[model samples]
Target: MIDPVIERPRLTRYARGGGCACKIPPGELEQLVAQVSNRVGPAVDPVAPLLVGLDGGGDDAAVVELDEQRALVTTADFFSPVVDDPYDWGRIAAANALSDVYAMGGRPLTAVNLLGWPRESLPMELAAEVLAGGASVAHSAGCHVAGGHSVDDAEPKYGMSVVGLVDPHRMLRADAAKPGLPLTLTKPLGIGVLNTMHKATGVVFAEAVDTMATLNRDASAAAVATGVRAATDVTGFGLLGHLHKLARASEVTAVIDRSAVPFLDDARAAAEDGHVSGGSRRNLEWVTPHVDFGGTGELDRLLLADAQTSGGLLVVGELPGYPIIGETTGFSGHSIIIR
Candidate 1:
């Protein structure tokens, strides 16, 4: 018998936007940030006022220095349908949102739902399933989804606003990668490309759903466990762009062994067939100037930089023999080089 608790979403019509495709594009997004019409109040004291958020090392949020010991971490992420199953969507969305907290080496204490749905078009209760899914993930993270806001919209969207606690010293940022540190990716690539193809042909693998819907929990756990200092999720920017941010912030260059990187099975043929999304291609374009591929197949390059919704975490850390590909080094005039 089917689990009555989770209703199956109608998959007959695939969304043009799945995962991070639903995200606002970069150029427009920068404009939005710049046009924040209100004049912000003066910042807290730099010397002391709880310097939690000031370091800006790709943390979930700028943590204000509350005191000498504790700091607050905040992160938010939400996206449209990446899977046909409503519950899976919720779980993946929650995972994506919570990852930021973990990336910063923080533990979530609470969360708020950020929701958008076309209630009149779809079953009102489907929205509830999404909420339940988010609740399930929040519980696993040892937190609660206390409350949230919703709005009526044409598309269905879900995610979270998470608040986590961190020791001021343990707050991991994306800026600490030093020369010679190895770069490792915790999860496989091609989620964005594969999902785009899934929409184009309805060719989702049972395994792919299992993969994408799976949490970044383990990946985040590994980062904290390994004490990997600089990290970020492989979201809409694609690997190279996010890596560029890391390299830029850390003042280091990244050298990746293209063959050493991971890829998903569904990715190979789909990217070649051009079932790619605008975001992935755009991501390719954005990072091309900063990236250099050493005869790696075009398909491989696309997979590496594909934009993802609730994607995996890419980590830069001290070298591990089994997975060592390349390392961070003093600026080599390139942000990233794949051998």
Candidate 2:
């Protein structure tokens, strides 16, 4: 149980943008990348062939072939606090960082902490709690956490850079999605709005915290075992935004059944209370051109595009226990169609 007395300084107060919502706008990021890629050209390394990189519409991680059967998956993710409790923030950030490896059908081998603390303002004890939380979660995932780098900064930040290994044959790729495959989401949506509410009203949502802190390892293992090949975890971009990236990369159209999508019990209520984040609004606007919302109400659309923090894997193929919220179809001008 969290001690109310010890939680004196609300961590969320220091964060300008909370969790994945702190990420740069997807549209602006893509444009910048496109320009840089055009000027720099493809980065070629003769030593180890890059199996997956930015050229393929930016996957969950950068994978490089290490040998005939194995490949190396590397990714880094960090964000500002999404919750008031430093320990929970650390766990959520660690889970979010490790998720990239799992999303690629890889098992994390090692990780290094990435921390930015306001040494002058926040107490160092809080940072220790945050690191301890991250370490505990990493240990549970069977990933080694070596010493990491820290910097004195204005706003406190935390996450990790993870290295993992995957079987090349069974690896999941965002660009591998194909038409006719069912889209399966392993977790529910609405984390963004709930977090937004929490940051504003100081009401802790236990369900949302658990959802964010839970690792995606089980879902990823299930996907690999089930012969699934295309998947990506939902994060700052939200479901619709991430789905748009997957569809565009695979040259397919994703058809989402709004009724079938799952949500937290109070997600709709939170959204109705105007707890939506600016990043979520930006997500909807960015994907507006590529998505065809068929009679879906504004509230539902906003919920669909609500930016997630440590969200779930949006797999292109079905899993037994998860819900099939949509299916991929041949491209019909638009990349995504919500009905």
Model 1 lDDT on a 0 to 1 scale: 0.73
* Per-prediction TM-score: 0.88, 0.97
What is the lDDT of every predicted structure here? 0.73, 0.95
Q: Candidate 2: where are CA atoms >4 Å away?
A: 1-7
Q: Tell me the tens digit of each residue's lDDT in model 2 across 156-243.
A: 9999999999999999999999899999999999999999999988899999999999999999999999999999999999999999
User: With candidate 2 superimposed using the best TM-score fit, by how many Å does residue 183's alpha carbon deviate from the native?
Assistant: 0.6
Model 1 per-residue lDDT tens digits across residues 141-203: 788889999999777878899988777775667787788888877667778877777766656
lDDT of prediction 2: 0.95
Query: lDDT of model 1 at residue 266?
Result: 65
- Winner by TM-score: 2
